[model samples]
Target: CIWALVITLLGYVLCSALNPKASLQYTFTPGHPFATGVEIDYLEPIEWLPQSHDQDRTLGAFWKYLAIVLSFAAARDWLMGASRQERRSGDGASRFPGDRMQWLLWTLAINAAAVSLVGMLQRLDGTQQLLWTFTNHINGGHGAFGPFPYRSSGAQYLNLMWPVTMGFWWVLRRRNVARRSTSHRSGGDPHVLLLVLAALTAAGVVVANSRGGFLLLVGLLVAVFVLMMLWSKRQVGFKLGVLAAMLAVLGVGGWLGGEALMARFRSEDIGSMSGRKLIYEDAARMAEDFAVLGSGAETFAPLYYFYRKKDPAWNGYVHDDYLETRITFGTVGFVIILLIFLAVWLVPFVGNGIPAPPEFFLLIGVAMVGILIHAKFDLPFQIYSIHHQFVLLCAVLTSLKWQRG
Candidate 1:
């Protein structure tokens, strides 16, 4: 199944890249009758092998897609091979050998904490330059967060990390509790640092001042807390701890950027959808026109010029990743992409049962769900860093012992 999906995607992309350009032209009649008609030309739809309007861009995108797929496969194979070797050597009792997962979680947590702290400090300092050096003219530097020009992108990265940090803390806590039963002296709990980092990372998302990120972070935290309460054996202490952690996160976040966030919400543009509705409406028309084959890969910016309602500015992205996929990949390519997504997400659960701790799965699931939801309102998936993090997480999921109960 995996091979079939991969081959199909590869063929689709290769065909789109190599196929000759189409000569189809779309004529646009202005909404106002007094306005002159505009004629726009784009790639014609070919059922067998779709052609992109811009062959070079499509070819470039194909290379990127190929690299991501190969990298994911290589990473998954290496991790899984290591697990198999450990089991054969009879070196560990756990399904995953050598505390590698713990190391990975620790690294992610520490890095996220450091990045979150920097982003928060930057927000407070009111600097238009990213990293206090590279000035961003776009969005007038107001949207700068961390190293990213867009606050939402920074929020997305932090959002992905904090949940994993929480899961790591849970895993460590369980191991420490087990060790304490065998030996009284188990040193200070290292998991405390992870919990603190998780809270700090969550606070970073709030300080990012992205409305979508803020809302999603709150929803994820609430959902995670509820899940933890339901699954935990020791109810009262665990509940209190989780509640306190959540409060600290929210309180810190509020203290840092709550005023700015509130001001954004109070602003008239809060309900305006930031003109996304118009983009969606125009994109729908474009999709209908090229319903079979999309204009081309990475050609939305150029194609949008013909479909835009009133804005003359060159729109770079659809903002909504899913919608952009549909617009650029067309219905056929969209279905192929959809299948690939389903396979990536569902394949890890297809074997006997999940061998990793349920808490780890739950937390990673929260991170994945949060990012996917965020993609609907922003371009998180389009950003290479966020996309790479997502792929890495998926690879980690795939490498786990799904064949074990």
Candidate 2:
């Protein structure tokens, strides 16, 4: 299942490299018909009678569908393919996922370094056009960071890496502490490397200067801190010490970049959240228009204009993912989407393998929740890397080992 997910991941990455942003032709005037360039109508009667489909397969569209199919297939396999070995592995040391997690973490760490380097060069040179081919004007604003042309996508991609490293760090640390040191069964510490990687990713987020990304990062830090403080199996004194250390790290980061961070928040106008609320308002009307069936899957851009207000020339995503999904898929689709999320979120606790230390499962659960929270404020799904990354993470979460403690 993981292999299937990874293959699809590579497929998306290559597809995205070939065609970035992928929504160019969706730009159209109000009352204009939705673009249906490649118009295959891939799976017509197979879907609901009135359900809509993609506008074109030009930009990363195929990747989206392919990734979804593979991911869901993997998820299905994971849920039904549970083995006796897995059920009894209450120590939370599932070989497949554990090895796969380490490999993916290192791969992401390398990617982070490359992205940070590119972003640094772009920032130093003050040239957003260096990575022009990879980004659209909308995402190409401040600086094109790494694979993504948009700062928000880059930040979100980097943000997702945090949980992978942190989860393993906790798992390995527990394993090491539980076993004898002289046993020579090494479950070495990933803290120093993962921490450095996280710092670099956070710096990239700051350098990208995405308001929502910045907010999400801050929220993530707090969430992780609170989780560690409250849920960690470490002694109380150790937990307090961890808290003090994290506070100092935050204080230093704020002190170093206080002005620029403040500027991002201050640059906004009063009561204005990047005009997202306005988009949501428009999306609400669209959701009503197509209450049962949706406007279409990727039809939001063209369909949005028709439902949009006269002023403010905006030609991009609705920004809010839930609202966007609601508007795109309508009420029925929205309900189904909500149910799927709830089902996955409950996997760890409901019937998942008995966690070695229960909180370990909770850590992974938090990672999933973080993305869901991030999705509410911005279009992380639109970003190339993050879109597929979410699919892969979903598969991982679904297949994770659960046991009777």
Candidate 3:
């Protein structure tokens, strides 16, 4: 079923790319009265070919999307496929390896921590370039975070990670407690490291000083805490410990970037919606113009030029991913994408039971929730690395087996 959805999506994109009728012809004259200096003299008649205004970009994006989807499928098959040892078990049961998941979680958490550390240090040093190398004149060094010229993007990345790291710690703690119950022995707690890493990652989100990121981080932490308290079989001490850790994360994050965060909140743009209203208004006009077949994939930037009201600058994205999708893919393509999301998120829960530990699923769910909500207010999905990570998480979630835990 997932494959069917994928095939349908790919087919649609290919049709859009191959549409003969969907073309844009224009002429550019320097110092023209037009804001873009290019005047569109003709728009090829729209047909039912899934045509895009910019076939070249749509084709390029299609290939990249196909590659990402295929690669994820291949990697998932390799990881979840039955091994010789599982076959020899003779019960016809198979599960994804718990140790492998743990390793992956650890690696991801450590990497996030390192990136957060770098971003925090960069903010402290007030360097005028990213990594003390590449200059970003638009945002300047203070506004940049880690390697991302846009601090909000960096914050979005960290927001997606810290929750997963916390989930890792929760899984480890649960397993450790289970072991202690059976063995009557207590060993060194390795889960502490995960907690620390999660804290650092959360702090990174705050230090980046993205308003949306900060709010989402707070919401995620609160949700995690509430879920842990309600679902965990552990004692009051463990719950207290978790609460303390969360508070520490908030405290440290505030200390690191509280001044900047507060100043942003106090700024006048806070009430002005950061000029998103104008972009959204223009984007809505574009969507109405191409309500059916859409202008085409990867065509929003160019098509927006026609609909732009106040801003003459090139707007790459609609800021709202859903709105942009509606403008680019049209209602039909948007529905197809929605079906794909439903399949990915719902399939795992449709069988005998959840394929993996419920707690792990909870964590992954939280991560997805963050990005999905962020997409409503920002372009997290438009960014390749962030989009890839989201897809990877979905693939991982679907590939898990109930018997694995």
Candidate 4:
């Protein structure tokens, strides 16, 4: 929690520094990133025009680098800390926090509580006062972003993660049923609470109506169930039942709310599938034009505008994060990213023999699949939400290596 808070604070500091004070005081009017419909005085508390050169992503990249370094250092310490003792005794000493999964579960519990509170705030504001006021400007619907001037999609993106964490808590709760039964009945089942939280998150997701969040949730459930069934040494009947239950809970629930959840798929709306496709194609075309290192980091909008002037119907931001990365950083950047992904997925499976920390790997795998799949539709990288999830994963991975040593 402290680490997450630090990272978030750093991110806001970076954002404040990079965004011009004039721009930060007012809401950024939507138009072409390159060309302007009207240059209004920038007096909003948060302006989003410079998103193609997102200060947030830059700040997050710095944190990612730090996390990678910290993970390595932790592993090193874990390995070396007990080596002398092992040599003397011929038996290795296990670390206190040997169960990385437990730590991850705890972290998710904290995240669930935080996100739930935020979701409640969003629900209260949206249903009561902000609905008509925000709708007047947003035109497409707006959920809730904290204090930012723009009606951001980022908060909704964070909300998507609530389900994954809630799921983790659910699994942990079930695992603890034996212990809990011996203790106190009134303690109530954690799994039941998690399920309720997941339901509430579903409601929030439906209200947010993020195409990326919706698609990602679908992909996460399918991937998790299939992976578990394929990998687990469990009965076929048991696996099938688990799969069915997951589908019923997530898929069926989503379907019941499909009217609002799938609203983005209906028109040329802001959060629609068709809109994202348009941005993706443009980003691809821009990448081709810039070639080598593409347009440089944070230069996508300027480059996009340069291209758009020739064609007046252009808008900024390729909604697809992969395409956006390719366009902003070129093939080299794209390849580097792909290799990082290959390491994360393949390293554990190959070296560790099924990844001992089941819950950690499960959440990572789910989130990876979720983000990568969702990025094809929405650029989640622009926000601080997804990066925080990665940080939690890194922390778990670090603690795991510590225990192994």
Off by over 4 Å in 1: 20-47, 83-94, 181-187, 352-354, 402-405
For each of the candidates, the C-alpha root-mean-square deviation to the true structure, in angstroms, is 5.4, 7.7, 3.6, 9.2
- What lDDT tens digits, residue by residue, belong to model 1 across residues 1-405? 666887887778778777746433434556432223334445455556677776777888888878888888886766554455466786545454235666566778898888899999998899878989997755655889888888989999999989988887777776667666433234356677788899999999999998889999989999899888887867576577778889999999999999999988888876657767777778788778767777677877767867888555446777899888887888888898778777776766774323666677788889999999999988998888888888878777866644333
- Give one digit per residue, the lDDT tens place, for model 2 in 113-204: 56755765576566666453433444325546555666677777767766555655566555655664543233235544555555555566
Cα lDDT listed for each candidate: 0.78, 0.58, 0.79, 0.49
Provide TM-scores for the models: 0.87, 0.73, 0.89, 0.61
Give the residue spans of candidate 3 off by over 4 A. 20-46, 82-97, 140-142, 181-187, 351-354, 401-405
- Among all candidates shown, the one with the greatest lDDT: 3
lDDT digits (tens) for residues 274-349 of candidate 3: 7788899889888888788777788887677678886666677888999999988889899999898888877666
Could you tally the backbone clashes for each prediction?
0, 5, 1, 7
Model 4 per-residue lDDT tens digits across residues 310-370? 3344455676777777775556556655655555454444443222435545655566566
Angstrom error at residue 396, model 1: 1.0
